[model samples]
Target: MTEQRFREFKMPDVGEGLTEAEILKWYVKPGDTVTDGQVVCEVETAKAAVELPIPYDGVVHELRFPEGTTVDVGQVIISVDVAPGSGPVEAAAAPAPAPAAEPASEAAEPEGRQPVLVGYGVAQSSTKRRARKGAEVPVQEPAPAGTYYASPAAAIQGELNGHAPVAAPAAPVAPAGGARPLAKPPVRKLAKDLGVDLATVTPSGPDGIITREDVHAAVAAVSAPVAAPAPVSRETTPVAQAPVQATPVAGARETRIPVKGVRKATAAAMVGSAFTAPHVTEFVTVDVTRTMKLVEDLKSDKDMQGLRVNPLLLIAKALLVAIKRNPDVNASWDDAAQEIVLKHYVNLGIAAATPRGLIVPNIKDAHDKTLPQLAASLGELVSTAREGKTTPAAMQGGTVTITNVGVFGVDTGTPILNPGESAILAVGAIKPTPWVHKGKVKPRQVMTLALSFDHRLVDGELGSKVLADVAAILEQPKRLITWA
Candidate 1:
């Protein structure tokens, strides 16, 4: 009989330097045939949700973990049977019975490492069943001859000692009051991080599964009373009453969001940027009357038809033009090298708020793109971001960013510089306000612009010039043609 060989696929570092990812979904299951380049699962990293493709064509043998489990990099997540006609036979045969541990002096060494995809490292060691803490060792049952074992550690150790391999014990059952809370691994991790007991959290998901929302809701219920302290008489306050409300109270009085994924990463980046970079913000109120008129004109223009032509488009273009006039503003502070790295090309980032969190996916080569091309790219970027389909690669290498707080009718904000980028421009609401137009008070389209930059790399003079240039272009729409 031909020996059927199985290959294990390890979880790779999908994002740059990402050490772990939560398996959000599984596309292929055991007994399913998959081809090379076929996506097997979707995983959520700190950066984004990415689909992982299988590198080898084979019949899936096993899925090592259930969906929502956060797996470390280089850990095997799936196994595939590669030998021809092995899948049917393997499927037909029942799981091998547990083998009795027996002693033998001569055993074979473990199999050689299998070929893996590029950027994916080999597994550190053969898989082993972790011994449960404080649990009694399970008794091994003897197996019939030629029974295949599942665990490589057991198989190798058994072979080395010339004994039959032992099967791992079934997972322990939860004591009374139904099984352990049914939560996805990520939600469970979030609950653990927030010091929440899953048993106390009420499951809202279908089939009584605990969701991230449920865990967060439980946390909110716990902290709500503290947020609004109700006056209690010393005589009425009892020790037992204090512990009664430890669990989540029904009725939504508050919400506690467990920060993770994009939101968690954004928080860390913002904190680091705010503390590390000395920021200086400069504000300019521009009469964008002409810019708004130009936007209207562009909407009706033959070439600009079907494109997203708005105030943002004009604002983005104005910023690019301003950067061109003041080339020194397009740079980053390299602290390790103690130097300013001036980028010749611009990867302009647009700050987008999605359901997941805030992500800045940039347009590549913004300085090189024509007006229509820029509009198309900007539309695509916004659409992708809104759909939560922005990839990690799209968010990297941003040289400058634009945050349009104006969409929410805010006046303006001193925007924080995106980490590594020198500056970020916040656009305010454009309202018809009385302004000095040609030294005469007139109702004109007015907007506030705030530009914040890394003081280490950009001085007051350079920043003012960049902001002034942008104001000028917005005030006079014809400047785009002259400036270009």
Candidate 2:
């Protein structure tokens, strides 16, 4: 009789050194047949939501955890039956063989070559199960040789039994006259977390699947009209309708959002950068009338058509040019090596405020890109960040950053350095102001630029040179061509 074998798929380290990820979804369930490289689940790491593909082709035997469960790397997340048919029929047809002698170590090294999948590490010799507290059941003796067992627990006891595990029953049916709400696992988890019933919420997604927006809309509907009590009758005293006040329950007036994910990582990096590096901020107010005019021209230009053309784009180009001229400013302090690491290629990070939190996703080799390419990269970066799809790799190895407080209508402020980056440039709102252009006072477009740098790597002279170069480029827009 052919023996059926089951292979366990472990939770991989999806991102660089990511230790854990929350199972955001399960695309394949038990009894479902999956093929190699087929996406089985979507997991949300601290970096981003990534879909995981199974490396082996088989029938899914079991899912280790439900959606929203955080699993550590190297943990088995699913089991698959490699040979589905070599179970009851084969076992009953063949003669039973005597059980082999047990080895001193339970985990015997696997024979032959191990299957290697990129990103995911090689399969281990044996799988280890996490002990469940108070849920431990007596270990059942291995089924007699040639017998088939469907349970994962039974399969794990020995390889003699290898039938596909039975699929779990479907969830309870919805109330009469309605079907269970169709939603992605993450959306369902979000609705559950917000104390929302998916059945009651209207679905706005394609094919009636509930979306995050739909769940939020439902919450808003419930929270709206807080003062729904009948209006005071004219019988007693006609009192003006008072604003409804939400009474605190259990003295909890403020909602505490747990700091995690991007927010938590940002806070840690900011605190570390702030204390570890000596920050010196230098501000310069520049007359950017020429730069603003250039921006308009670029918007109308055939080359720049259909691309995002704004003050930020020009400002970013100015910074890149400045970095090129004052290359010394683009460096990082390596404390362990006691050296200043200068970068020839610039990964220009743009600070974006996302729904999740502030994330600095950078454009790789921005210094090499043309104006149009830079604009495209910037647009893609901003859009990806806004959608919370920025990956951890995109946010790494940044040489410098630009935070545009100008978009928020702020004049100027000292910006904090992103950890490892030597300098950060903050662009303020560009407004029409009276400024001396060629020794004549005129209403010209003006903006403030602030450059904050790590004093260890970028001294006052270098920081000032970089900032001044950017300012000069903005003042005289033709410098970009000459400088390039």
List where candidate 2 sits over 4 angstroms from the true fold: 1-4, 31-33, 84-212, 220-251, 437-442
* Model 2 worst lDDT window (10 residues): 90-99
Candidate 1, residues 87-139, lDDT tens digits: the string is 34433221222111232122322243232332222222332222222222343
Model 1 misplacement above 4 A: 1-4, 87-255
| Clash pairs, model 1 backbone | 100-142, 104-161, 107-159
lDDT of 2: 0.68
For candidate 2, the TM-score is 0.70
State which candidate has the highest TM-score: 2
Q: Give all TM-scores, in the order shown.
A: 0.67, 0.70
Best by lDDT: 1
Against the reference, the lDDT scores of all candidates come to 0.69, 0.68
